[model samples]
Target: MAETIEEIASRVRELRELSKVTAEEMAEYLKVPLETYCCYEEGKTDIPASKLFEIGQRLDVDMNLLLTGEEARMRIFTVTRKGEGVEVERRRQYRYQNLAGKFLSKKAEFFTVTIDPMKEKPTAYSHPGQEFDYVLEGSLKFYIHDHEIILDEGDSILFDSSYRHAMEAKNGRPAKMLVVVI
Candidate 1:
């Protein structure tokens, strides 16, 4: 079974408490509303992978701890078998499978993202650093700021993640892509 959002949220709350960090402090650090952080702890809302990574950094824990409830001790190399990667549910239409969740002190976060088609427009999000996305299957409608780009399988793009960006599935089907954030 894929990892549920509730389980991840619970781990977030637990780690925050163990670290003795207040919700207000986390909210301030994330630059999000206090209620938003509270919702994340309460499992009332799905937490973005980027936000979870930020939490891991701020809480001085590895992202694997938050995603798998297990610490990554290997600094050399780690391999996640096919169909065994940690699944992260960031939104109803977005499913992310962490490709390097077991490697310690990762300088970059990698994921295989599966995006389902939506009737409504997707919300764009921004974070510090840069992002590279390569379409693996199907097609995607990608938006960066006010520019829109259509990417088919085998196409790739790299951009500053600070700009608001979002992606939607094309042809009313699910799309898959490889995403690396650094």
Candidate 2:
């Protein structure tokens, strides 16, 4: 069964309690206001994918634990069948399939991202890592820092993800790509 946002929120609250960490501490660490963090933990708001990843790292757990309620322990190899990845709807126009969510102690996070064309200005998101994107279908206009670049199928890019970045589907069509964040 697919876990709902409420379920994930409950796990977040439960895990933090078990770890003896206060919500305020988590909010401070995430650099968000206490109210905003509380909303996410209470299921009043959908938690962003980056924020969820940060939470998992801080709790010393794999992203699988946060998404599926199962601990990932495989150190040898893990295979995710096509269309079998954990799905996350992080934002309105973005759908993410976690390609390696069940791999434990991962040095990088893999995802297949499907993005719809924007209706307004795309929101910029940034994290403290590097990112790689390979377009698999359609076209994407990627904005990094202050520049915009158009990428088509089979095109790939590697960039410092610490700077603000965003993407929008081009030609009035959706874009799909493989994303690796490290």
Candidate 3:
């Protein structure tokens, strides 16, 4: 069975308890309000991918442990067949399929992202890493800080994820891209 948001939240809570960390500490680490962090822990709100990543990192565990409840045992290489990667439902407008979720000690996280068409660009988010996005289908409006760039099929970009960034599907259609977070 696929992992549910509540199940992930329960795992996070259990891990936090085992690590002897307090909810207040996690909220401060994520730079989010106490209420917002509590909602994530309670599974009352969807947790952003970046925040989840941060939590996994701070807890000294791979994101696979958080997402799948399974430690990565593949040290050589793990191949995820087409349409076979793990899906992350972190946001309403974005759908992410994790490509290398089982790879141990990966320097980066690989994901295939699908962006649903929307009239307005959502709020930008930042994380402590670099990001690369390669457009595979349709068009995407990419925003990095004050700059906005339209990426068509086959186009790609690299930027610092620590800077505020957002992505929006264009032309009343969905967009697909390969994203690498390092």
Task: Give per-model TM-scores.
Answer: 0.95, 0.95, 0.97
Candidate maximizing lDDT: 1
Model 1 spans with C-alpha error above 4 angstroms: none
lDDT of each: 0.90, 0.89, 0.89
What ranges in model 2 sit over 4 Å off?
A: none
**Candidate 1 lDDT by residue in tens digits, 28-91:** 9888999999999898898888788789889988888898898888789988889889888888
Clashes of each: 0, 0, 0
Q: What is the lDDT for 179 in model 1?
A: 98
- Residue 87 CA error for candidate 1 (Å)? 1.2
Candidate 1 global TM-score = 0.95
Report the C-alpha lDDT of model 3 over 100-135, residue by residue, as the tens digit: 889899888899999999767677898888999999
lDDT of 2 by residue, 1-182 (tens): 35689989999999989988899999988778999999999999988888888888788777788888888877888899998998888888889998987778899889999999987878888776799999999999999999999999999999998788999999999999999988
Q: In candidate 2, what residue range of length 10 has the lowest lDDT sum?
A: 1-10
